[model samples]
Target: MQETSVTKRFNELFDKLEHCDEDEQRQKIEEMNEMINEMDEEEFEYVFTTELFNKIHEMIEDKKISLENAILLLKYIGYYKVLKGIRINGFNESSLEEKFKEIIYDENEKKDEDKNEIIFVDICECYFMLNNQFSSDMYPICAPCLLNVASSKEKKEEAQKKVEVALLALSNSSTVNV
Candidate 1:
């Protein structure tokens, strides 16, 4: 079956990620990221569907796309949803939150120094925005990883600084709203 034009456009975008070399991958992903802002609201239903997300997840599982790029795609896709005030129809909120927990709160993943601390930070930012400015956990899921980022005082100085502020806000606000 022939896909709709919107699906095809986004598939092309994902394909760019799939096909590019390491040098060109970031640029292509950025290209797709920027294009998301330019897309009309009419296209969002197609763009943000569960099937689309499943495709991205499969791509990640298959090693067809890097986790960084997939997360970047999700972050911008999520921002566009929030900024446009459109909630995805039939999307399971818990499933997404669970996935977020797996990404952020994994103890085994946390022990690796090579793991991207910035992804933890970015996930926290994205969670707040997508959850209507609410933190998912009272203590926050990424707090352990981010706390280390702060306490170690290493290369991620900016990440460390952001973590401090986020933890403060997370602790203060999560109890009040929901």
Candidate 2:
């Protein structure tokens, strides 16, 4: 199969993201966000495959990319997946689950309340978007962080939004019961 223009553009953007410094990476991410927003469901889904997701996930795990940037990329993808009603394939859910656990359980992140809350909300939203593919174990690992965000008083509106997403995730996970 031949590569589409969208694939070429996305790859170019991702390559820039990989090679750029933090400032450049942020700029590249913004550009990528724009590109994604312009794509329809089929166009967007065609650009992302399981192998591509694994490569991005590896970048996050290897510390080659900042967690915030990585999560930003993922949240965009996850949001589109939900919006398009598409399912992800070929990605290893177990590996993602473990990484999410590490992020949620990290003491350093926990110490920074604002950052921690943002991470938790992004992650919960991602999980909610990918609800069909998640393992039962995901609920247990994510529940504590979600609960923390739900009870947080500092960012009431955002917290409430996250809480609703968390509840949706938990509600979906209950049907899996695996």
Candidate 3:
């Protein structure tokens, strides 16, 4: 697909993200969010390219983006995915979930880990949105995260049904229980 103006602008933003400090990175990502927010349905095609996922993975690996900003970007990915009603068996672009799983599971292993309930919730929301329906190789990673948040007194309110379906899917899958 030809690169539209939006994609070109997003590319420029991604380049700037590399040289930016934490505060600057946040500002750039917020700008990105605004750009996406302004897009019409048809313009979404430009911003929703595979390159977006690729850049997100690169930025994450390079530590050029914080977890909060990473989550912000993923929200748009999931949002556009829903808008396009696109679902397929394999994403074939990036194993984005593995990176997040590492972050989350690492936190899970820490002593006195301040479980950022919003992180877990946002991740669960994105996981479901980015997957093929509720099924993906992400089940193992997302299942635990979702289950954990589902038990939270404050954070569980929105994810009740998601937690249930993840449980049902977990029982049916051969993925070893965590």
Candidate 4:
């Protein structure tokens, strides 16, 4: 038979526990606590043995409860398979941030090379030097640092645009020697 997902099972378990009276909840917590105490992290993760599954199935059968409540009750037992789904299954958040930085750097390097623009201090570097913080290291800038750098960059761009427009207007107004 196809195995039900941990998340689906956990949701069912949560619902059942929520519905139970205090006495039932206390009993349920004790059962769950026992199950948790028996397993370490690795065992908890991969040791979803048939015995546990059968015990859950039996609980549903004995309770004559709806499938939802059974799931919830099992969830209350706290040994439900749903925990596997909630785990941080892949790369760490910091690794993801580093990957993002790589993409941004690749794009920026290409743009810089094409434009023949030698920026002595890129925004990342400027933010770091001025604030004594590493901004590009995993979008590592704090909120205040990001805001300050963003506003400064915006102001610089606006000034450059005004200069370019002024130069263009001056050339248009003046007669060329040609």
TM-score of each: 0.62, 0.71, 0.62, 0.23
For model 3, which pairs clash?
Answer: none
Estimate, for each residue in 37-96, the C-alpha lDDT of model 3 and write its tens digit: 666655665555555666777777878787678777676656555555544333334566
Q: Answer with 2 or 4, whichever has the higher TM-score.
A: 2
Tell me model 3's lDDT, rounded to 2 decimals. Answer: 0.61
Instruction: List lDDT for all candidates, in order.
Output: 0.59, 0.64, 0.61, 0.36
Native RMSD of candidate 3 (Å)? 5.9
Weakest ten-residue segment in model 2 by summed lDDT = 168-177
The candidate that achieves the highest TM-score relative to the unseen native structure: 2
lDDT of 4 by residue, 8-112 (tens): 343344346545765675565455445544544454444333344444444445663433433333332222222322221221222322332454455445644
For 121-160, candidate 1 gives per-residue lDDT tens digits of 6665455434433444524455454455445545676756
- lDDT-wise, the better of 1 and 3 is 3
Ranking by TM-score: 2, 3, 1, 4
Candidate ranking under lDDT, highest first, comes to 2, 3, 1, 4
Between candidates 1 and 2, the lDDT winner: 2
Clash statistics: count for each candidate = 0, 0, 0, 6
lDDT of 1 at 128: 45
Candidate 4 displacement at residue 106 in angstroms: 52
